[model samples]
Target: MTKKTVPVKPHRRSTPSPTPRPNPNKPKPGPKTVPVKPHRRKPPK
Candidate 1:
């Protein structure tokens, strides 16, 4: 009777990546605003 031998392989595990964090001190970019004139009105009939 012959005995069969099984080969064992090494298991490799992947490491978790680090998460990116936002800066709290920096100000957020906003849309541009246009200035309006106060005397810019329509004339009455």
Candidate 2:
């Protein structure tokens, strides 16, 4: 009886793409303000 040998495949490595940068010429949005709730006081014992 004769034995057959199998060949091994090479592994591949992937590189990540660069991130996009924001444009400085564009105007920024205004800040938003939230309403504050009224403070409650405890009754005197």
Candidate 3:
């Protein structure tokens, strides 16, 4: 039987990848600007 050699293939990148969008499942980092605080006032004696 004769031995055969396989040819090596070259690696190539097509184009630059686009920027990824923010994930919707993850919560955003920052305090809310709403003026509806619940723990701001205390009960009267």
Candidate 4:
């Protein structure tokens, strides 16, 4: 009765770094105006 065997090592993953882009002559945000109410619907008999 004799059994001994342990050797397992294989795991290396590190490659993903490239993200930096946000700056293009900042100034673009203007379009939001809604004011007009007129709704009346009720006739069914």
Please estimate how well model 3 matches the true structure, expressed as its whole-model Cα lDDT: 0.70
Q: Which stretches of candidate 3 lie over 4 Å from their true place?
A: 1-20, 31-45
In order, how many clashes per candidate?
Answer: 0, 0, 0, 0
- The C-alpha local distance difference test score for the whole of candidate 2 amounts to 0.60
Clashes counted in candidate 4 amount to 0
Please tell me which model should have the higher lDDT, number 2 or number 4: 2
Where is model 4 more than 4 Å wrong at Cα? 1-21, 32-45
Write candidate 2's Cα lDDT for 1-45 as tens digits.
787686865566455556654876776755744445556545579
lDDT of 1 by residue, 1-45 (tens): 897786865576555556744776776665644455568656678
Whichever of 3 and 4 has more TM-score, that candidate is 3
**Weakest 10 consecutive residues of candidate 4 by summed lDDT:** 32-41
Indicate whether candidate 2 or candidate 4 has the larger TM-score.
Answer: 2
lDDT score, candidate 3, position 18: 77
* Model 1: worst 10 consecutive residues (lDDT sum): 28-37
Q: In angstroms, what RMSD does candidate 3 have relative to the true structure?
A: 12.6
Question: Tens digits of per-residue lDDT for model 4 on 1-45?
Answer: 687685755566555657744865775655744444445445567
TM-score of 4: 0.14
Off by over 4 Å in 1: 1-21, 33-45
lDDT score at residue 11, model 4, on the 0-100 scale: 68
Question: After TM-score superposition, what is the CA distance of residue 29 in candidate 1 from its true location, in Å?
Answer: 0.3
Evaluate residue 39 in candidate 2 and report its C-alpha lDDT on the 0 to 100 scale: 65
